[model samples]
Target: MTIVVVFIIVLIPAGMVFFFHHQNKLKLRARLMREAVRNHEFTFHLPVKGLFYGEKALQEALNDLGQDINKLVAQKEVESWQKLTRVLTHEIMNVSTPIQSISQAYLEHPKVVGTSLEKGVRAINDAAGNLVTFVDSYRKLTQLQEPVISTLRLKDFLEGIMELYHNITWEIGIPADTVLDTDGSLLRQVIVNIIKNAAEAGAKNIECTWRDSALRISNDGTPIPAEVRRDIFIPFYTTKSTGTGIGLALSRQIMTMLGGLLELSEKADAGYHATFILKFEQ
Candidate 1:
């Protein structure tokens, strides 16, 4: 009788403790989900360390849900942006083409000749050219396709890109011995975009280095403001007065597709550094 009573008492309290712990964990997870939603962040996984019963199963379920929601959101956003780009480009081209044609006709008209009219035509032509360039940059953003990856020599590929930026001196620290398997053209685009931005930011000297499967590009220029750095990779976010703000976003997309990451870090003393981490293929 004594033994039976003791066993019952122990089992009952033990079970209660276990149940309470599980319930608390579930509550914590629910709180995290709510917080994530409030912050406009996609929450796809439960808290890493605070998981309750069936941790693996819950994680898998949450991951699936998160991915599905993210996919749907991205699809809708892309469709909307594409439609906007098409409409805007068409409308702008329509306006620009007629102005260009009229300006040329007026400039060449023998019946009408004046210095003021000639100056007006030149101004119209210059404005049209600027608009065309702006539209072209947006077109590039919307029409990016997936890259084709292959084994490529890192040194040669980087040198080819640096050669294009002839105005700025490049200090390369890449190992000639290292080779990488990646999308050569896409990688080149990423590097070019960074270097181009650096040049715009008053960077006279640019340094490119590769170490431990990571590529770091540093430039001696004005440091990017902390507020702008947070959203530098976001679509339509630009620090430049005339920037289209899609280059960094596209580069990040390409890197993500290639199982890599693009990150920015402020230099301790001066300038800023952007790093691309390429995962080695298994």
Candidate 2:
């Protein structure tokens, strides 16, 4: 009877205290997480351990949620840019076409041929023609063909591009059996554009590296300055003397459409190489 009295007097109260302490700990953890999310502190990573299994599961779920949110944000941004480009190109073409047609007609009119204004009209006509070409290029930029995805051997693709520049020295690092899923024709255009740029830049050696679902094409030319690098992927931004400046921009857009990524990384070592990185989906 005395032992039973002790059990009710001591162990019962201790058990209640322990249960309340655990509940308080879990409540504190949940409150902290709510605060972090409200403050937009997405970098928060939960500890791997806790007093209960539910806490560990919550940590994993939070980690995955962060990753998913990041991907969704990136995808939305790309879609927004593409939509803007389409609208801009469409409106520009509509305005430029009429000007081009009118200028040409004025230049060819028999009565205007011998007038003092003839030379001025001819100049206007030439400018309008240039505008037409620029508009057409923008049209192409905004309306890229949907890629037909297929499995392709990387080495074979690189070899074909190399053949086009026989005089340019190139070292291909991809193995013969290395393969990836991509649209051969579209990807070929992207790679060709990069190689062409390298050749035009007077690069002596071009190195291609492939690993872990990424391909890096590096050229031993001039190292792009930090300021210029920021604008390289922007449409109509180019440092070249005579270039449309949309090649890299279009290529990046295409890669995004294919659920991949394309970017430029510079090497500032002795070689001063400019590298274009292409990342494919796993």
Q: For this target, which candidate reaches the highest TM-score against the unseen true structure?
A: 2
lDDT of 2 at 89: 73
- Model 2's TM-score against the true structure: 0.72
Q: After superposition, how far is residue 4 of candidate 2 from its true place, in Å?
A: 43
Residue-level error in angstroms, candidate 1, position 25: 2.3
TM-score of each: 0.62, 0.72
Candidate 1 accuracy as TM-score: 0.62
User: Candidate 2, residues 196-243: lDDT per residue as tens digits?
Assistant: 888888888888888657798888876677777757777778998899
Q: Candidate 1, after superposition: displacement of residue 95 in Å?
A: 1.5
Give lDDT tens digits, candidate 1, residues 64-109.
6764564455445545656777789889988987887787787788
lDDT of all the models against the reference?
Answer: 0.70, 0.77
Collision pairs in model 2: none
Best by the lDDT measure = 2
